[model samples]
Target: MTGSPALSSRIAELEAELAELRAEQAREADGAMLKVLLDDIEKRHAVERRLHRAEEWLHLAEEAGRVSAYTFDFATGTLDWSPSTLALYGFPLDEQPTLGRWLAAIHPADRPAVQAIADHALQHHGDVDHRFRIVGPGGWRWIEDRGRIVRNEDGSAARLVGINIDVTELVELERRASLDGERLRLALAAGRNACWDWDLVTNQVTWDQQLGVLAGVADFGGDFDSFWALVHDEDKPRVRAALDRALATGSDYRVEFRMVREDGSIRWTFTQAKVVQDADGKPVRLVGIDSDITETKLAHLALNESRLFLVSVLGASPDCIKVIEPDGTISFMNSNGQLLMDIADFEAIRGKRWVDLWPAEAAPLLEHALSEAVAGRRSRFDAACPTAAGTPKWWDVSVAPITAEDGTVERILSISRDVTDRKDADDQLQLLNAELHHRIKNTLATVQALARATLRSHSDPAQFEAAFSSRLESLGKTYGLLRSGPQAATLSELVEAELGPFGGRSDALAIGGPEVLLSSNAAVSVGMILHELTTNASKYGALASPGGKLAVDWTIEDGNVALSWREHCGDPVAPAAPASDGGFGSKLIDRLTRQLDGKVTRVWSDDGLSLTCRFRQSAD
Candidate 1:
């Protein structure tokens, strides 16, 4: 080829320089290899580029795989790590790897196991595939290390080269998978269930063989018609409608229905189904489970019936009946019980502590009752409490424990009967009985006094009997007035009891007095005094003969009763002394008058005997 002038001149200059280089190389050594030196330079540059590319690929592989290569040199007792390996331990890239840092980075709990693996590998020259943990500035990470130990001829570990791969996510996934498996196992073991799959578009149903066992049949048909035939006739249409609605709304389907078995016995089942939808939210399939729930259903029904029966019994009771929880809270109260308690809304007081519901005055009693019940015993108390409407009541409350099958106290029962009326009646009865007893005792003491006086006055048996019997009769008449439902008797009533047998005003006997009520003591004493006078008058006074006149008058003055008695005997009167007996009658009069806390005075005149007495009447 012909060269241009500039090209020719440049080639001539290169040849001239090449001739001088050849002469200089001949003076040196190996002048014949100088002609291939340019080709060798080209090859050397290509090798350098390939080495740079390879290093870039290695660094990328380490970073992308979350991996780092490690090397441990036994001879130097030093460890070497790439930049990624140092970063994995939370160390700066400029930090050099050291044996101490490497060993310290291992988790304390995992260190011993790792050491054992290393020791075994050193002695046996074995391959290692271990998983462990390491902690750094970055919390902790799980690492799966796989490596082979290079050994010397004597089987001592010369070096260990391995890759550390982060496996935290894989470990977590495995743990979750294990837990899910355990849950599935527990669900299957909890009950007898028959699983099914339904293809909505194909109208096909696939059921497990357990369905036949539930239906009391030897074999079950796999088609939808066979499964539908097992459903009770009354429930089929409802079941179909429910399924349709569930699919329409893409919701879960739950139903409880009856299944007639082959033996004509009824069984109950609960079914729950889930719909599988496509990407566009259209239903594609249904997966369901049919669980045998006959036992549970029957028990629930029986429990409900028992509860109803108990409710009826409590409703029929006239007393307040309450059920308390173990925590001493009111749990249930019958409708009638709420009415008796005057609680318009039971919810207002529900869950309130039973002790808190009582008045402070009755809290101690209520607390004691509750403690007794909690200890599995019975206690009773009678206390006064007001209702919710503030009506006062006396309640006879009986608290008993309700026990569970395990013999533990499960609840408390409180039955309160209103006893306000009964309590009042009992108090009144006690008071009447006490008063009657007291009066009877006093009467006996008075009788002793009458008998003693009669004995001293009349030594003869016949005379003594006549006087004592008459005195006893007068005392009896006095009590008759006192016993008439009042605590005291009228003064007039006491006087008439003793004087009625003698005569009225028609027979020349006069009696007048303002109405006055006297206590039992005053009545007894006054009656005795009047009787003594009457006995004397009838035997020796005006009543002893015809044409004799007798009169008695009384008045209340300054809280005291003043009485006057007079008589006209048709003959002139003698001295003011007893004419019917010795001084015994006068002495008896003196003694009874002293008992009245007053005095009796007598004045004799040509007319008759004038006797008057003054004393205070006791109200007690």
Candidate 2:
């Protein structure tokens, strides 16, 4: 407007033209906006129609599904059950629901358990999906209840929402299926399984294909009389009676009878039947199974016969035969064994420890033999084992290991034979032989000692023979005395035998002593000593001269035999004193005294030679 009037006037017309175009554009935009708004309304209406249809379908599904929805308000402590829930509990649509009425509908037997489960879920904010029985207007029904805890922002349970479903039909189907399964299992357990069905009202029979094939009749008759014809004539009455009892009581029928097969052979069979009843408890049908038990029956009979044979064989054995368990306990003992062990009743000892029956002192021996057998080895022992009645007897026992299938020792068989007589005879024989051996050996030893002494004293062979023969004669006499008793000679006997040759014939010999006995071995030692002294006296001292005298005396001192031997020469001066360690006579006397376990002391005086010896008692 300030630039020029003509420019201002053109600008006004352009402004009006721009205003008209903007206004027309606004009108077009308004119409398009209205169209968009209408389109939005149509889409919303379509979604709403789908949603409403879905809700209606849901309600119908809830009714048909036998399910009811429920919600419990935690704060208000109010429970709301949907219309379907009321119908499930047999309540009218307008019935007011109450907690007490809901509780009363639960079956008495299931109330405590259901309440416990509900309480646990509530305390732990847990989900619940379980089934229980309830008595409703529709009668006893099974209910499947499920619930989820609705949590607030803080995760606290604000409400419990769940559904209840009537599951009575499902429960009944499960129970019937379980019963049928049990019947099938029983049929399978029966040997040579076959099935049959009989209709009581029509008296008609139906056989499974397996039964017909087994009966040798693919086109088997479908009547009660045809089924009865299969049973043996002798068993017909008993089987009919069983069937009658089952029908009368509506119970099961079981009987074992004989049936003639197509091969014209009679075999045993076990037949069992279940009676089916109608709603009024009337027997309507009989379902049964037949199992052939011929093989089993024959096996049992054979086993019994075998057992009798084994018992007879065992009874015939005289020896004590015992069967021991792997644990070293008595399992069985044969009749003869029971008598031997003094057991009146085998039952009294059954399961008793086998080792305990033996004496405690013999436990070590018995246990050692048992271990050997347990290690799969055979063992034997001969010992004096007494019976229960305390009768002493010796036995020769053999233990053999009995192995099982796995080759481990499972049992032990012990056989004991009485050996008392043999043992006694052996012991007596041993004692006699010992006595004979001692006598022979003693004689030989004495001969050797005499020969050695004589050779030591005499250098000439003839002189040695003369001296040795004389000593041998004295030894022979000593043996004669020993033979008079038990390989032993009295002290007096030994002394007299030796001195009699030198001084017994004359009054010059003197002897004094109490009765003292010496063993055969000790007698030999003392005899040698006496013989040496006599020889020495006869050669040089007393027996060499007429007036020489000899005196020998023995006494017990300190539980030992002490012997004193003295010689008188009848000369003023001592007969030249015998060399201490020189002559054979002196050495022989010293050695023999030591052999007697005695010490010797000698003194030479004006009289002659004096000697003393002490020897202990001995046994040959």
Candidate 3:
């Protein structure tokens, strides 16, 4: 349908205008869409930057704290680990994450329990907190794991996410601390000491279990005053003073005191304490240890008494007793020893070497003896000790080593005795014994010779018996004279003793001689000669007649002795008989003269008989 021209033109213009407005609206909408897209892109970039920063912070936190994050999927049996988690497990990034691999990383000893714990947490959808060890390339590492389980829709366990922390250093420190505590306890037990702590502000005391045992109490109340009251009355003031001094000077306290036990018995205790000071240097607490020392104290006292007794005994000894140090110094010498050395002061020789005390000639021997004794051997010797007075004295010395408990030589002990008098007496006895032996032998030989002669001279048994008895009686008298004197007999004494039995009258016999001491040999020989001569005169020579007379005289000259025997007023005598064919009396005179190393002469005359003999005057 054709409309009017004016209406047609307006409709056309309206359509064109509508077309232009629609194009403008479409351009505006496209520009708005571009603005929204740019805003979204900027917001995403900001979020990316923040995410990068957060990831870096988390990595730094994990490394600093030694922590690693892990996730486990139960259904898939898979494990996921962060970079730090892999490093903690000693696994490289290229290694695949799996439950088996994670379980393999756990220490063999703890694997079974760790797996069980993880399994229980997964099944029960429970939280997990466990500490365990894991094997790594470096070594074993302790791990503390904490995680929360995620459940599925059916309320069953699904997954686990957790953090793992390396606690190796912490575990090692804890273990060391535990060992130190145990060592301290053992030390206290071994020492039999108790540890105590006292607080000054609260006046409260704390004691270890050992202290309670020492106090003889099961439940010890930590009361300071009560513990002080247990101290002995004599020791209380000392203990209090020590504590006060320690507190005032902020120093360590040490004291030894006595305490009364529950049984009312006394016990010695050694206590030491350190004052714990505050910031202002005021004492706040005291820490100390106490030990029982009753046995030690008693032993020391007993040792002192024993030493005193030993000194007393040594001083009372009569022998020359000395104690020498190992170095040869004279450590101790009794009074007798000092007197033996002629030293008035013991200090003069106290520190002197033992060898120096003796003469130089005996020093070597003394040194050898000391060395032997120090080597733990006993030594003995006889030595001539020159005293301080310069007199040589003989001594029998003995040295013995004194040993300590450890089998080492501690000192040398020496004892000396004077033997001079004993030695002199022994020498005298020896001389006398030899003289007696010689005299006995000569007497026996003479008796034998006399018996033989008597047998030959007498044919009748009765006559022979009387003659032998008379000779034996004369021999017995001579022997008695020899025995009466110590060294020798006087010539006059011997003559009187032998002749007194026959006829001691001056009218019948005359005896004259100078005073002379005859040797033992000479005395015996002279006595026998006189006895024979007297018997002969009495029998047949001169004394047999009433008017008979006998003369006997002796003289000494130039160490020679001359003796004469004369008889007169008797029967006429015959020529002197040869000694070989002489009777027993004549043979005896010849033999006795020969023994005397002299000569005998017999002259026969009508008036009487005369005899002369000469010998050395061994007679003193």
Q: Which predicted model would earn the best lDDT?
A: 3
lDDT accuracy of residue 614 in candidate 2? 86
Per-residue lDDT of candidate 2, residues 1-620 (tens digit): 02223234545665565566556666776777666655655665576566557546656767689877777767776677777788788888767666677777898998888888877876777888989987777689899999999999998888888889888999999999999877775665554678889999999999776676556565778999887888889998999899889999988899988777777877777888999999999999999987777788788779989988988888888888889987889888889888887878989989988889877887887898899999999989887888888888888999999998999988999988878778888975784475356445545644664455456557899987777777678766765664434577788988888665443235778899999978877877777677667656665566555577888898986659989988887853334565454664565567667766678888887678888888886734
> How displaced is residue 506 in candidate 1, in Å?
11
416, model 2: CA deviation in Å? 3.1
Top TM-score: which candidate number? 3
**Cα-based TM-score, every candidate:** 0.46, 0.39, 0.49
List candidate 1 stretches off by more than 4 Å.
1-190, 234-241, 278-282, 405-407, 438-620
Q: Per-residue CA lDDT of candidate 1, range 148-219, in tens?
A: 787789987788877788888888898899998666645644676777899978988887656667778777
Model 3 pairs in collision: none
Q: Could you tell me which 10 consecutive residues in candidate 2 have the lowest summed lDDT?
A: 1-10
Q: Once model 1 is optimally superposed onto the true structure by TM-score, how far is the C-alpha of residue 558 displaced, in angstroms?
A: 34
Local distance difference test scores for all models: 0.76, 0.76, 0.77
How are the candidates ranked when ordered by lDDT, highest leading?
Answer: 3, 2, 1
Candidate 1 structure lDDT:
0.76
By TM-score, the candidates rank as 3, 1, 2
TM-score of 1: 0.46
In model 2, the runs with Cα more than 4 Å from the true position are 1-191, 198-205, 213-219, 222-257, 275-286, 420-620
